[model samples]
Target: MIVAFDFILLLFVIICAIAAISVKDLLSAVYILGAYSFFMCLLWAEMGAVDVAFTEASVSAGIGTVLLIAAVSKTKRRSKD
Candidate 1:
């Protein structure tokens, strides 16, 4: 059961990573990267590294997301293609 849960989380992380890179919109990519960071935190917690997970959650998913969102918000939206 735990293995199955881990697999599902891993799948989500992979999807988020791909989506973050593939998305053209800066805001959307930042949001997806935040999701990816959250999934990584979960994966670390599930693997029994609570300390690492806490750091990932607090630093990456929390503050990092906010910073990225702010950066994206300050930029003018434009399509390259």
Candidate 2:
């Protein structure tokens, strides 16, 4: 059951990463990247690295996501060449 949970988390992280990189909308991409980081934190916790997981969760899922959202809010959501 633990292994299954890890596998699912890993799969979600992979999908979120792909979406973050591939999305055209900047805000959506940033949100997806945040989601990816959250899953990574979960992965770290599952692997028994409590300290690293705590740091990752606080930084990536919390501060990082807030910063990214703030940045996105201050700029245009789409880029044009």
Best by lDDT: 1
Residues 1-81, candidate 1: write the lDDT tens digits: 289989999999999999988888888888899889989999999999999999999999999999988887888644453
Provide the TM-score for each candidate, comma-separated.
0.88, 0.84
The alpha-carbon lDDT assigned to residue 32 of candidate 1 equals 93
lDDT digits (tens) for residues 1-81 of candidate 2: 289999999899889988888898998898888889888988998999989999998987889989988998998889541
| Candidate that scores best on TM-score | 1
lDDT of each: 0.88, 0.87
Displacement of residue 16 (Cα, Å) in model 1 is 0.4
lDDT accuracy of residue 81 in candidate 2: 19
Which stretches in model 1 have alpha-carbon errors above 4 Å?
79-81
